[model samples]
Structure formats: C-alpha cells, structure tokens
Target: MEEVAVASDGRALTVGSQQLAHSLFANYPLTAAFLSFALAQTLKVLTTWYKERRWDAKRLLGSGGMPSSHSAAVSALAVAIGFHDGPGSSSFAIALVLACVVMYDAFGVRLHAGRQAEVLNQIVFELPAEHPLADTRPLREPLGHTPPQVAAGAALGLIMAYLMHVTTNLSS
Candidate 1:
C-alpha cells in the first residue's frame, strides 16, 4: 500500500510507508552511521572467534565487547554529520557531544560496572556450598571497552564515514 515518488535527482523513494523512514535511509549520514555499527559488530564477532578459537554468534547482538559498538555508532554518526553538514553546524556539534558522552560512558561507568560484576562473580564462586547464592549464575562480563578499544572504535567510525562519503560521491 505504498506509493513511490521520484526525487529531483531521479531516485525513486517509497512514500506513504513508514512516513520519513525511507527518507532517513536516503540521508547519507544515517546510512553511514548504521553501516559503521554493523561493521563494528561484525568485527567484534571475528575478533572473538580469533581470540577464543570459537565462534560466538551471540556477539553479533552483545554489548561491551572490544572496539565498542556504542562508540563506533556514535562516532560514525558524528563524523557523518560533520561530513554531510559542515563541522561548524549545530547538528555536527550535537553529534560530537553525543559521541563523546557515549565513548566516555563506555570507558568509565560501564567499565567500572564490569569490574564490579567480576568481583561479585568471584565472591559467589568462593562462597560456601551451603550458601543459597552460590547456585546463582555468574554475571555477564565484558560490559565495557577499555580505552584502547574505544580509541580503535572511534578510529574505525571516522574511517568508515569518510569511506562511505567517498564511495557515495563516486557512485553519484
């Protein structure tokens, strides 16, 4: 039940669909951000497999892994915004702030929480057999990225955004 509308540039866009959803994808910044996130998650899976010598499909949707997907997503968004809208634009400023917040949280609060979880998990393991909490499952670790991981993710995001911009220009 959707109608198609031709853009001024001759690109056909679906209308009366999700109302603005298609338009969002048509925006290069949004597309770059999403692609960066996908690539980061995919890299996480590959990194895990390489390190552990086992494939962990769950990593695709998991958080707190190396090269922080959160960092990658926000950084890519910021970079893309800077590219699409000039760096002096308010949109770019907002995106940069958001990216900084996300990266900080990944390296600060989340990292501390992960460490706390590890300690609690160790405590539970050392508990006496009669302790009721001893039977509880261990907490999920790797809830945040190290500084290096955040840096790597941010670098990846910036690179991907630039690459996307270049590729889109070439295609156009």
Candidate 2:
C-alpha cells in the first residue's frame, strides 16, 4: 500500500509515484549524491570559463577537473548515510570505505594515468610530420584530479550532505 498526499494546488503525490521528480527526491542519499555531483561539475565549468575566458560546454561532461565529481558523489553518499544511520552503523562504515577507495583512485591511479597520457601526447607531438600517427588526435589529458581538487570535492560533499541532513530534519 502506498501513502497518498494532496497538495494545496489540488495535486496528488504518492509514495511510489512514477514521476521522475518524485522518485528522485524521495531518496535522501541519492539526492545528496546527485546534488554534489552537479555542483562539482558546474563548478568545473564555471572555473574553466573564468580562466580560459571562453565557455566550454565540454567541461560539464568531461572528467578529471578541479573538484572531482567522483569524490563529491561518494563523500556525499557516505556523509548522508552517516547522518541517516548513526556513524557507528555498518552502512556508514561501508559508505566510508567506498568513499576512501574512490578518493584514493582519483588521486593515485587516475592521476598517474593522466600524466602518462600527457607524456604520450607530447611524444606524438614530437613525431615527424610524415609519420603515420603524427596527425592523430591528442589524448585526453584532464582525466584525474590533483590532491587539492580531491580535497575540495570531499569538503564540498560533506558540506552539501550536512546541509541536506539539516534541512530534511527541519522539514520533518
């Protein structure tokens, strides 16, 4: 059985409503993670535009920029879980571990990969004009976050989760 509520506008909302808005807003952790990801991505876009003085829509979809979206998402999930289920709970512990692994990968393995790509790109650029691969498209270089970017993302996630938790508590 699903609970139903009617709004002042005479609109009916159900607990299991099939609407996209309803479904997305109904889950706290998911909402927090999504918001964090959006914020991080938006920040990347804005910062890139500010520095480059040009609007690059690609930044919105690209990865490996300042404020790692991966870090923001996992950290948001972990913090939200911590708030919903006591920090000492198993769920929180799992979320924390997951966040740790994601942040580690962003800072370590992915960063190294990005560096390697840069080196490869340089090698390709230095190749002779007559070389078959000389004109190939350069590799994507911004594929991992620096340590500061990861830290910024983690902080943003924690702040967003805390705000969401507070607002949810207040509304309830």
Candidate 3:
C-alpha cells in the first residue's frame, strides 16, 4: 500500500513518488464553498458602501449582513457535496445536516446574542463616569443574521454551487 499524506491546507494528497497538487478552483465542492464565502463577504462590503455611503473594508471579514457568509459557505458546501457525491450518499447527508444547523444557529442563537450585546452596550454607555464598569469597551453587536439574510445567503449558495458544479464537472 502507498503511504499518502494529506496536505494541512487540504489542497492536495501527496504520494511517495509525486505531488498531486492544484489550485483551489480545481476541486468542485471546495471551490463552491470557498467562492460562495468570498462572494458573500464582497457583497457585504458593497451593501455597506451603498447603504451607508461609506466604504467599510472591515465588512469583508465581519459577520451579520444582508446575507450571512456563514450560511452561504455551508449551504454551498452541502449542495456541492450533494452534486458531487449524489444526494443519497452519506457525505451529502452529513453536509446537508451541517448546513442546516449552521444556518439555524445564525438566525436564532447568534442573532439573540447580538441584540443582547447592543442592549448591554447601551446600558454601559449610560452608566456614570465614576462607576467601576463605566469604561468598558462596547461589545461587538453585529454577530448574526436575520431570517431574510439567511435566506438570501442560502439562495446565493445554491446558485453558486450549481454553477461551480456544472463548470467543473462538465468541462472535465
């Protein structure tokens, strides 16, 4: 049996005599998931610039936007796996469940946490200067996605994964 090593970055699997390596785009599911994530982040930047009339590069790496990047990525991963491995396969089932869990958490638990943070921050800001906790930094309030945000992200993910699947699989 050949001893093989999986790359830490998951870009390739290496055999003793040769290296099988390629760009991220070469892998259908991986590419779909990653590109979906990047596209969602880029969209956040654009939406911020349009709505706020300011360019906020930080949105590219931040959470909570018109579309949830977390939802986009996981949904794309699930769909892509379904396409590549067949919807009835174990891999596809795992991916689909993971996507559902992530999206649900984004809409429910995380959203509540962000809202709570906003309230706490307001309370802190109203505290008297002499209070012991008055100087605490405001919490990060944009930590989750609303229902519409999660829906949009899931739609984007489905489209992106379909496109990636077609292009990658058909062309090969």
TM-score of each: 0.87, 0.85, 0.89
Find the 10 residues in a row with the least total lDDT in model 2: 15-24
Between prediction 1 and prediction 2, the one with superior TM-score is: 1
Cα lDDT over the full model 1 = 0.88
How much is the lDDT of residue 115 in candidate 1? 95
Per-prediction tally of clashes: 0, 0, 0
Which candidate leads the pack in lDDT? 2
Q: What does candidate 3 score on TM?
A: 0.89
Instruction: Report clash pairs, candidate 3.
Output: none
Across 130-150, the per-residue lDDT of candidate 2 in tens digits comes to 999999999888888999999
For residue 157, model 3's alpha carbon misses the true position, in angstroms, by 0.7
Could you give candidate 1's per-residue lDDT for residues 28-79 as a string of tens digits?
Answer: 8888888888989999999998899999989999887777888888888899
Residues 93-144 of candidate 3 have per-residue lDDT tens digits of 9999999999999999999999999999999999999999999989999999
Top-TM-score structure, candidate number: 3
Instruction: Evaluate all candidate structures by whole-model CA lDDT and list the values in order.
Output: 0.88, 0.91, 0.89
